[model samples]
Target: MNRPHDPAPGASPAPRATDWIGTPVTADLLRGALDLERTEHGVLPHRLPARARAQCADGQLAMAEAQPSGVRLVFRTRAAAIELDTLRTKMAYQGAPPRPDGVYDLLVDGSLAGQASVTGGNVLMVDMTTGTAETRPGPVGTVRFTGLPDRVKDVEIWLPHNEITQLVALRTDAPVEAVPPGGRRVWLHHGSSISHGSDAASPTTTWPALAASLGDAELINLGLGGSALLDPFTARALRDTPADLVSVKIGINLVNTDLMRLRAFTPAVHGFLDTVREGHPTTPLLVVSPIHCPIHEDTPGPSAPDFSNLGAGKLQFRAAGDPAERAAGKLTLGVIREELSRIVKQRAADDPHLHYLDGLGLYGEADFAELPLPDQLHPDAATHRRIGARFAELAFGTGGAFAARPA
Candidate 1:
């Protein structure tokens, strides 16, 4: 096999045309995607299936599910070099700053092997002030990873968690085949932006991805950014997906959007759980409350972008709703935590497999003091590692819900 390699931090050169073998990006060679749509350019992975997506018209959910936070190409190959042609849709905010290109993480035999990013692609420009977006067409880009050990090994190329990527083509110097399932428990997780990998170093470094690694489980992440607002469609998506372990991180997005009052939130939570139970009656289901966000702990949200530092090329967020609104049934982080705890406790009376996790135990005020959130909302990369470690301990540790069972 040709041993072409690149040391630069960005894109890599593709293998020579005639010498490389082409492989179709099929669902069997992919993980973490609930549905795959055949686009004009290539295949697009979707976190939510077509039925659920058809029910919602919200733009945020549409974009979030299409980003493929935990999606990756998984296969067995002896290829010394690999190349992926992709059409990526990158996001840009008007008057703010150009976000860095999304990263692609490569793993060999469950270990991080290399990392790279595709350069120019479609740009989705959003006007933060007007809440409107325009898409500008661009060309497909290639990301290559070379110099493998040249032995039979399992390989995974994790797609960017924050960008919409359409897989155009995959090429390798050697032949490729479907990797047999590794027998790891499939962990399906649903959460907010933090779980969606905001500010994470790479796709595999996201908290859910990290925890999945530490827990020795295969992951299907449904962590939609800014859209986990207890929507029925989202809950249905979680219900329909097959998984051995299921976790839903609630409250953060609810508070961020101020989408519902306490009365509505309670029934919504129950209904969401009910739908999931229909599909997974005895599956181990864990409900996780939101982590500590000082800005939204007591203050109700309708969190708005703190563009005060936009001129300095930094964009932060701030809670816009008044704390006094909580008295009038408005939801806050603190209130949501308390309600989630109560609801889980009440339902656990009959549901032996149901569990509740306090997000504070994962990243509380103490941790916040040491590693503050850069955007005043999402955790930074370091915090992502910390949270992932704590979660693995709490949920998959001995006597935890995801602990291994002996035959």
Candidate 2:
């Protein structure tokens, strides 16, 4: 029953089986979603919207903004077999020992095709000695992939950069649509948990999806693992989504979640760069700061969790605040890279498309003495391919800081 072939001479015909569950998943076939909502058991994908998830009700920023790190679902198909039906949530830890399921990669026209996972949806749990949490729901699972290569290309799938998905239903065996918008340049970023790919390996080798595939662009990752915390609903979810390029990174989850000081982190980094410059007034934002972690680079945190190699099953992280708590105003990565390079050179004197990298110019300290951070604070998978090839040769090559502005 792998059907999905006949329809050559003049094409356009094969969508029968009662028109495959009435197709339509719309929103231009999803691609790194910036917002998709419609919940009640279908389509969730929000990198942060619904008014920045209703201005925070924090369950770890609602499980890191529904965990869709570089979310995906693209389209264009001559389906040989496909079925999505999600509703995931996953994430455990209570007594420990389960973890490792969320994957779902698929690709196709852009290569590596096939890789799936989905089993009994919702879970959550977490306890870590009274930090407290609970979810436990479970049900809609599905995943199916079957042969695929019946003709019309581009598929994608991706999802699960650490489960929390929602989606819910998407059968197929022939007709499918939206795979259009591809001139690249979307970017958007944001950070923490090493740009939410902690211990990176999949979800397209995240290092902001390998610096959005060496800066050709189109990422939208809002890297929320540990919720990048500069909230104001993540600067109004980066001032209402739509980006041509913009970054944020900022201090290691506010010095490992000690969450604030240095007078409310310099007015929460000037009210999160004034609500992302009221929707990217001039785009090209940047602002990185925070890398060479080495126990929070001058220590100060709420970090703690180092089950001293629990009989070698490993689990580490240590800076539990206090390098003499920087005379009480805390905060470290060397005082958030000298207050984000003095608030991006005092707001680049009236924001000249403001910029400021220095996250140790992408993982500093002699590449951490030749690549270290094996969980003293993220960055693995060959330091996410050496910080996505040094942030595509420092922000898209040529004169950097998100180059491309020559007319």
Candidate 3:
């Protein structure tokens, strides 16, 4: 049997028509269609400082000079009370979020309703370094809604969570809203912590947010923090959401999270797509694998923990042992880099609308080797900006496959 990294016996190239990488097309209809969009990185986990240098180009937007320089992410929320969680990781030396001040602007059906209290877990951080994980709630905040005669239409939140969000519960009695009519198109993204930005500057700075702006697609950021395991439930979630264009970024997630065996990895991926196909049979779907991270590049770690941050009774994660175990047949970035073409090839015989993109198309091993993740994990704000811009160019720029919702 060939290793997951073996060459394809007979594989064909991706369809050029579907590839808008260098080609260019501009459709005016695509702007402003996103009901919920995090096209840029908003500070996460209520941690990092809200600071972005305004360097937005013709097709790019950043605030290199804006006061409170960080961008804010406002999302529709329709609940009496909302609960938010922050993160704890092996990376950051500081254990708390920068702001911990959770009340952000709230919009009720496009109306400003003051600020909402962030409840349940003030700075909830999960330690994944000990070979096992331990989770604790940080601070609890509650936002009370009042004096509405009838059912409320939507809940909007301005975000700059500097730490990270592990779980979110929208406490709303209203039903999920119906899809708006005649939007040109919608783009859906699925991915991991990088997608989640484990303490990147903020929610808006995360690449997914920036990419949405570049493409002008109604964005559904399903980039779960530490939860893009190619799980069937997640696949079900993607399959259920309505979208015109969809993409899944896989690989580094599987490698870093240390989930699945080689045998299970590829099949799980296929199964994930299979579930998605059940819902979106013909929509253009892109499959993206991991970008480069030297940490797991050659070592193929179920990674050993780095307990340097476990301050006095402050809960330092357990360290990884030598020879980070490589249980046979499990997958790694090195493995994925070597074998992704073959895996995608097997699926191509029947699925033409499906496509594959090497994650490095945005950032590569060379980039990581030079930039290096501060926590030996997630990228810095500069890298995030770089990746977001590249993604906009290749995925949605001129030759991109995005179209705005027809209004």
- List per-prediction Cα lDDT, in the order shown: 0.91, 0.80, 0.52
User: Model 2, 200: alpha-carbon shift in Å?
Assistant: 24
Arrange candidates by TM-score, descending: 1, 3, 2
Looking at model 1, residue 364 earns an lDDT score of: 96
- Comparing 1 and 3 on lDDT, the stronger one: 1
Q: For residues 353-406, write the lDDT of model 3, one tens digit per residue.
A: 777777787889688767767667678778887788888777776555443323
TM-score of candidate 1 versus the correct structure, residues matched by position = 0.96
- Please give the TM-score that candidate 3 achieves against the real structure: 0.60
lDDT winner between candidates 2 and 3: 2
Residue 253 in candidate 2, Cα distance off native in Å: 1.6
Worst 10 residues of 2 by lDDT: 1-10
As for model 3, its CA RMSD to the true structure in angstroms is 17.8
Query: Per-residue lDDT for 39-105 in model 1, tens only?
Result: 9999999999999999989999999999999999999999878899999999998987688889998
In candidate 1, stretches whose alpha carbon ends up further than 4 angstroms from where it belongs are 1-15
